[model samples]
Target: MPQSIHFISIGGSAMHNLALALHQQGYTVTGSDETIYEPSRTRLEKQNLLPAQTGWFPEKIHTGLDAVIAGMHARKDNPELIKALELGLPIYSYPEFIYQLSRQKQRVVIAGSHGKTTIVAMILHVLKHYNREFDFWVGDPIEEFDTTVRLSSTAPLIIIEGDEYASSPIDSRPKFLAFQPHIALISGIAWDHINLYPTWDEYVDQFESLAEAMPKAGILIFDESDDMLDVIGQKERDDITKIPYLAHPSEIVKGETFLITKQGKRVSTKLFGQHNMKNIAGAITVCDRIGITEDMFYEAIPTFTGVSKRLEKIAESTDRTVFRDFAHSPAKVEATTEAVKQQYPDKKLLAVVELQSIDNTNKSFLDKYKETTDAADQVAIFIHPGSADSGEQITTSDIQKAFQKPSLHVFTDSAALQNYLLQERDASHIFLFMSSETFGGLDLSNLAPKLI
Candidate 1:
């Protein structure tokens, strides 16, 4: 019989995907979570992998269980976690298990403060077009793929969006540290997760460590557009092959974007923006290293719509449009807002961002937003005053002053902000909602239609 494996907190995107992957691998999988959200809850139920109910139970821990996978959401003192510790069963963090499975496969680890998901999705999309059999684990759900995570015993390659966040409670190392890929790509370095790495230098140190972990003969791909990455990538690393890429050659003709290839052929893409162009270049470099030719990369890119929530268009009318993006970091916020502004240069841009993540909630990180929202014709910064329950010391006024943009508005309440948008938004405007987390209780989708 296959071994029995249980997950302590299996409701998360990564956790749920891992649980499903294990089940597909012939393991008898059971999992418990305090709560499960849509898509995950539905997907789990479809596979008969949903827990009997929500909340952890110590009784679920047993000697018959061969392994336990604990999610980062679960604390070290969680009842299931404590029981698993007492039982002395083999426990693996989600990334640890991914590393174990990909040990024999040629792994490509994509790391960055932003754009990792898009780059990985681009690579996966091109590979799929070529009918190349490879497994991947991305952070967001790709429309073309059924699941965010996939694993196969016979697949020769594995692609992973290697995040720098801590793996689990017991394991404080960044999630990417476990992979130690044969070929690695660092998109760029930007200070983020102030709660984790309190200082910018400390945050950069993680990427340095990732660089050092590369095998002697492995390759390191980096973005030359980022001076910080340029400095780090150019440093004397004797063993690794370093390849640098800037924004791919492209042109905007009659408001349409097209790639200018080495052969002088112009190929158009469904996606837009300079950031996405850079993302495409990074993915193309990886594909070239993996034996895919330049022609194939360009040929496959036209069909790539993009990963969900990176820059998803929610609703559109004849004269107005609403876009929702998962952009919370200072760098991401700047890129996302700038992308929208550039796309609809003539349209009045109103960018609304929720300071939901731990870093954005911290007072020290507020200054990073300085001029980040300058591209927007009007900017609204929303913060759930109660988001930082730990009392790390931050105020909406501090964020307002930090941005230094005259048009910036700060909101502690979502209702007032919603009302402001409804009343102020006009037919010739583009509304962009940016956040890594959901707006306090507002559904951007439901609100999109009313805007029109």
Candidate 2:
């Protein structure tokens, strides 16, 4: 364990959690972020870990620090980063430091464009169920755990949610590349991060690179359903153990989802969706290899409602339910929308979305979402056309033409969309808000009550 560490941008969700985890492990943890937000600010303050002041102070980066963990939000030329570089201090990007900590442990890295968080969360949920000792790093908050990152000396394994996004400002490599795992699971690969991985082939090449990074004897578990993953799984690799899994056979009866195991055992769960079933299969395979039994996996999974924002239920009435999900990417959007509609075939489905990232709004990426909206009965897209916005040129006609949904509603202002939805609340329906961004800055949690 690192005795003393300084975080360049601690206010970030994962970064703050890692800092808190290290602090709990008896390490000296200090962090600096120009601006800190709600949960991060409050959590850090609770632990007395909040910095005396905000912003970078090069003087704070001294020789006594054991190392520096840089967050993605931090710049290449941050004053503290510059000072750390000047002092010849060992600087590790967020992912790099996580890798360093778990190098000796059996590293299980779940990597893909989508479903990574769910798969990782499922694995962790099961591991904890049977009292199996392990540390984990997941991207989103889970109800099973207080923090997203955990480190313990007694744990013999570590599970990581491997993201393909760039590690940090100075580190150009993808974050997942840092975690050379003993067990690697690629849930599914879809072309994403158009701004960074400009071409379809280039986007896929990142997954191939991840496969190449694994040790010869390492076990690679992948989604056989994915064409790209199928190709990767079939490619010659005599030394590595390759395992392929598809969606667990299941049936949805009366709004309930049940997973049918290989032995024909029906496992009931609160989770819904074919994609979630596939995520379960991927997680089950990973856990099975790590010595968890089919029964144990089944027993633990039903307890996991879901990770935060992945098809999470925010508010509900007798007939209407409102859900908010972190699904900005095309694949995620299609799966989440389809899942909700599948679960409630009799109910009216309204899928609201906000394309937050620049990559999500790119014209080249528009084709990816062509058929995604077709799953919903109605589609409402909210894009704030302002100074920092992407897809400013995109119009309702373009979206209508692309999605083939002539009734698609496009709103540049959140207020108008809110008003429209509030007015339309007389109908009992399942309102699904799907976005990596908040619905044009509308407080959906607060609004959900009124809609109900």
Candidate 3:
């Protein structure tokens, strides 16, 4: 008989992907979740893998199950979890199972507190351009890829967006720790997830531990431009190969960014920003390690549209443009704001950020966002007053005081914020909506047409 696997809280982004992967691998997969969201719900339904209903049933757990995979959303008190533990079935976190699957393959883990999704997307773009078959698991949906997760036994390469977040409820270690990578890239480090890591040094230590997890023959690729990474990369790891990459040589002309390659080929890209240029360089280094040459790297990169929500253009008019980004952290907010400003310096820039993610909503994390919005011609910071979870709360005054920028505006009500934005936005201003979560139920897409 084929192996049987069950997933707890399988409706999550990564959990659903893992369930699909296991099913594709010929396992008799079953899963349960308390709630199901779109995209995951639709994708899983298409695969005939959606649960019969929303909630979990303890009866679904049986002794015949070969293994169980638990998601972070699943609590220890979950009936299915209790059943699985009672039966003594082998259980794995999503990352743990991925590590097991890619153990023999050349695993390239793209890790950092920021830019992980973009860096992973960049590497995948180049590999896909060359038509080289490889399995990958990224966070966001890519335009060229069918799904965010791909797994195959025959594929020789696997690239994963190595997140520093917890793997599962039972696992306190960061998810990246599960993948003992043959090659790894640390883009940059910044304090995030205050609820988890608690301190700046504790967060920094995760990357250091990730570097130490690499095999002796493995190569460590990191960003030399980041001062913290530069220091961490130089830490005495004599057995592994340390390859540090700086930002790719580039210049902005007429508000357009072009990359100058070592071979003198000037490659212009639709993607903008110094941070993106740095991401491209990091991707190039990883691609080189996987046998792709510099010429091919430059040739393939021009076709990259970047991952969805990483500065995704929602609508465009003769006089204005609207962009939506998944930038929620301090560094990401700064980088994305600066990118938009630099891209359209002649146009007035209006940036609106939602404090929905854990890092963005935290009081301690707010200080790091001090001057991130300084470049914006006008800025609005919106936080849903009743949206605080896990006892984390931030008032409008707290946010205003934290940023200390004269142009900053704070709003607790999403509707009021939307109204304010509609009034403030004009034909000459570029509107950028940034958040890792939904805008407190505001439909920005519907609002975009009215703005245009």
**TM-scores for all candidates?**
0.95, 0.96, 0.96
lDDT of 2: 0.87
lDDT of 3 at 179: 83
- Residues 219-302 of candidate 2 have per-residue lDDT tens digits of 999999999889987687758899999898999888889988778988898889989989999988998999998888988988
- The CA lDDT of each predicted structure is 0.88, 0.87, 0.87
Q: Give the TM-score of candidate 2.
A: 0.96
Tell how far residue 136 is off in model 1, in angstroms. 0.8
Task: Looking at model 1, report the run of 10 residues with the lowest lDDT sum.
Answer: 387-396
Residue 316 lDDT in model 1? Answer: 88
Candidate 2 Cα errors over 4 Å, as ranges: 387-392
Alpha-carbon shift of residue 316 in model 1 (angstroms): 2.5
Off by over 4 Å in 3: 387-393
